[model samples]
Target: MANTPQSKKRARQNERRFQINKARRSRIRTFLRRVEEAIASGDKSAAGDALKAAQPELMRGVSKGVFHKNTASRKISRLASRVNALG
Candidate 1:
């Protein structure tokens, strides 16, 4: 329905951005799932390693506008707390 050339270009750009963001979000979720699984398995070292790896991916999601800043912060905080509690 994009009649104007500019609108068509914008639609294309939006679609591209959507795919990229979707992939980024899925990647972030995968990293978070790894951490959750490690935590659930009660392995402190594995959980720590997973958290370390996931932290950057989550932060990257925030930086890339895939996630909100506070949302990422909250997730990191909660995961860190859970990891710390696995004493």
Candidate 2:
């Protein structure tokens, strides 16, 4: 229960932020999934393209504070390696 006006305002802001972050997280997941699917399909070129597309989205997630920089970097590294292996 937010008794004070400031607390109420904060609660509203929190809800708004939660929704926004949720959407961003979902979008990131969608990009990751696309890369994974492309990889699984055994098309190196498609996977590479998908990885290229996902890279910026992952970094955007980091920039927006949805994901840690290291985490994004690690994911990108792993995905790149997998894509390379597909060759």
Candidate 3:
């Protein structure tokens, strides 16, 4: 459907970006799952550690444009509260 050469090139670039962003999103979800698992297991220390690991990954997702900044911040805030409440 991309008749123009420029359009074809853009389609290719968009596909590549889609793959990259998909991978990044999956990675961030994995980190979040770890935190959730730790929390569910009722291990405060482990949950805190997992949250520490996930926070930067989430922020990186924001920096990479895979996630919105406020979305990442809200997630971190909620997770931090859950971890703290475990104390």
Candidate 4:
């Protein structure tokens, strides 16, 4: 329904941003999954490594507005605890 030229351009921009944000979200999920898998396998070292890798991605998601800051912090806290409990 974007009949006006400006609206049509904005619609296109929205679509592009949606695709980019979706990809970033998916990438963040992949990092989280890696940490989960490492924890599930009871590999403390691997879990720690995965957590280290994922920490930045989760924070990046917060910075990019894909996730809330406290949500990311909570996730990192839970994952760190699980990692610590492994050893």
Each model's lDDT: 0.98, 0.97, 0.97, 0.97
The list of candidate 2 runs beyond 4 A from truth reads: none
lDDT by residue (1-87, candidate 2, tens digit) is 999999999999999999999999999999999999999999999999999999999999999999999999999999999999997
Better of 1 and 3 by TM-score: 3
Q: Candidate 3 clash total?
A: 0
Q: After superposition, how far is residue 81 of candidate 1 from its true place, in Å?
A: 0.4
Question: For candidate 3, what is the lDDT?
Answer: 0.97
RMSD of 1: 0.6
Give per-residue CA lDDT, model 3, range 1-87, as digits (tens): 899999999999999999999999999999999999999999999999999999999999999999999999999999999999997
Give lDDT: candidate 4, residue 20: 91
User: Model 1 over residues 11-60: C-alpha lDDT tens digits?
Assistant: 99999999999999999999999999999999999999999999999999
How would you order the candidates by TM-score, starting with the best?
Answer: 3, 2, 1, 4
- Candidate 2's displacement at residue 45, Å, is 0.3
Candidate 1: where is the Cα deviation over 4 Å? none
TM-score of 2: 0.98
Mark the regions of model 3 whose C-alpha exceeds 4 Å error after superposition.
Answer: none
Clashing pairs in 3: none
Instruction: Please state every model's RMSD to the true fold in angstroms.
Output: 0.6, 0.5, 0.5, 0.8
